[model samples]
Target: MRRNMCRNMCRNMCRNMRRNMCRNMCRNMRRNSERGPTARNRQQRNLKIVDYFRQVFGEWAQVEVVELVNDGSGLAFGIVGGRSSGVVVKSVLPGGVADRDGRLRSGDMLLRIGAVSVVGMCARQAACVLRQCGACVRLLVARPAPSNAAPLQSLGASQAPIVPSRLLADPLDLERRLAEAGHDGFGALCEDTTPTSPPPTVIEESLHHRVRELLTAFKKKLWF
Candidate 1:
C-alpha cells in the first residue's frame, strides 16, 4: 500500500509540475502578445543584414531602397561580386535612369531585389534576379552613410595658422618705419619729419601709368 501511495504521489507531482510550466508559458506568451515587438527590435532586425557593412566599408552603414524604371534600354547599372566582397554595384551609366534617380550608387551592396532577399547570392544569381524583374524594379542595397568627418576635417584644415605679432607686419615696411624714426645713439628721437607715403603696389602703379598716358594724349589733342 505504501509503495502504491508513493507511486501515486510521484504521478501527482509530475502532473502539477507540467501544469505550472504550461501556465507560465501561456502567461509569458500573453504578455509578449500584448506588448508586441518593440521599435528597437524592428530596427535591430533591419540592421542585421548590414551589421557588418560598416566594418567592411569603413563608415557607418545604412540600407536604402532604389527604384529604377527601365524604358527598354537597361537598368543602367553593373554589378560585380565575390565570396569575400559579396555583390556590389560596379558602375552606373551616366544620364541613365538610375543615375537620374540618384539613389543607386557604385559600391552599394545588393541586399534584395524587389521582395526577394539577395543576401549571399552570387553575381550570376543576382543578375538573373535583375533580368526577371519587372519594368519597375525595386532594389534594396546597403550603402555607407555620408561621412561628416570629412567636412569637420576640412574646417580644421581651413583655419589660418596663428602668427606672432612681430611677424605680422611686412619686414620691409617695418624697416622703413624704423628708419623714419631715426633712432639716435642715446635712444632720443631726432626731429620728426612727415612720414613718407608707402611705395605704390603693382596694381596702383599700373593705374597711375594708365592715367599718365591718358593725360599725355589729351594734352597732344589740345595742342593739335
Candidate 2:
C-alpha cells in the first residue's frame, strides 16, 4: 500500500511538470509568430525609403550634414513638396548661409533638419520646424552628383524662398516653378539637359560662313 501511494505521487508530479513545460513552449511560439510580421514590415519599409532616396538622388545616397546660422526667420533655402512626395531643395539663396556653406545645393533631398526628421514632413511642416529652431539649424541632406550639362538660365533671380503659407496655399504654383526651373522632379534635375546639337563653337561658326560663301558662288555659276 505504501509503495503504491509513493508511485502514484511521483506519476502526478511528472504529469504536472510535463504540462507546464508544454504550456511555456506554446506561449513562446505564439509570441514569436505574433512579432514576426511586425519586424519584417518595419525592415521592408526602411528598405523602401532607402530605395526612394537612391532613385531620386542616384547612387550617391550617403547622408551629409549641412549647418546654417539663421539670424531670424529663414534658413535661406526653400523646401518644396511633402514627405510623401519628398521635400527637395527648390532654391538656395545667393549669399545666404546655405549658399555660403556651399554644401547645400538645389535639388538635394533633405532628410532631417536639426532634431526633427524632415523625411516625412511636407514643405510647410519643414518650414515650420526651421522657424522653430530659431537662429541655428543643422541639416541632413543627400546630394546628387553635379551634371556637366548646364542648367537652364533662370528667368530672373530665383523666386524668393516661398513662405510656408504660400506653399500650403499654392502647391500647383510651386510645381510650375519647379518645372520652369528645369527640375521635373527629384532625379530629373541631374539628368543631362545639354542640347544634342549645341550652338556652334567659334571654329564651327567660321566653317559654316565659308561653306555659305561657297554655296553662294555655286548658285551664281548655275545662274550664269
Candidate 3:
C-alpha cells in the first residue's frame, strides 16, 4: 500500500510539471507573435506620418516650437498635457511671411489656430492639417509681462527654409526602449530626480488621518 501511494504521488507531480511547461511555451509564443508585428507597424506608421508632413505641406508650411510652463514642483522635462496647456505658433521661417512681419516671433504660444484650439492636437497632427487646400490659420501668441523671462521669448521664428533635417529622417533607438516598458506619447524618456518622495495627495492624507484617529480612540477605550 505504501509503494502504491508513492508511485501515484510521483505521477501526479510529473503531470503537473508537463502541464506547466506547455503553458509557459504557449504564453511565450503568443507574446512574441503579438509584440513583433505591433512594434513594426507602429514604427512604420510614425515614419509615414513624418513623410506625409513633408509631402503634403510642401515647403511653405511652418514648424512651431513650444515652451512648457513648469510647476514649482520641478520638472524632469516638459510635456504638453494634451489637455490644459495650449500650443502656439512659436516661430515662422523667413520668406514664409511671418518672419517678414515683426509681430509674430518665438515665445508666442499659439492659443488658437484660426478658430481651432490646439488643445487635443499635437504638433504632428497640426502639421498634417495645414496640408489641406487653401487652409488659412490664425494663431494667438502668449505675450508675457516684460521681465527676466522676456529673453527666452526673443528666440523668435526661424528664417531657414524647411529642408532635409535629421529629426525627419532617422528614428531614435530610445523610442523602442520606451515601447518595451509600455509608455505611449511624444516626449522621450525622463529620469526621475527626486531622492525622497513628497507628501501624498489630499485623499491619502485624509485616510491616514482617519486611521490614526481610530487607533487612538481604540487605545483609549476602558473596556477591552
TM-score of each model, paired residue for residue: 0.42, 0.44, 0.27
Question: Between which residue pairs do clashes occur in model 2?
Answer: none
- Which regions of candidate 3 deviate over 4 angstroms? 1-90, 133-135, 147-224
lDDT of 2 at 176: 47
Give the per-residue lDDT digits (tens) of candidate 2, residues 111-220.
56655556556898788767877787866565553454223333333222211221221233433455565442312122222122323474356545655665566456
For model 1, the stretches where C-alpha displacement exceeds 4 angstroms are 1-54, 149-224
The TM-score, computed over Cα atoms with residue i paired to residue i, of candidate 2 is 0.44
Clashing pairs for predicted structure model 3, backbone only: 88-109, 88-110, 89-110, 94-159, 106-156, 114-138
Error at 76, model 2, angstroms:
1.7
| Model 2, residue 79: C-alpha shift (Å) | 0.4
Q: Candidate 1 versus the native: TM-score? A: 0.42
Which ranges in model 2 have alpha carbons more than 4 Å from their true place? 1-41, 146-224
TM-score top scorer:
2
Worst ten in a row by lDDT for model 2 = 160-169
lDDT of 2: 0.56
Given candidate 3, what's the lDDT at residue 106? Answer: 53
The better-scoring model by TM-score among 1 and 2 is 2
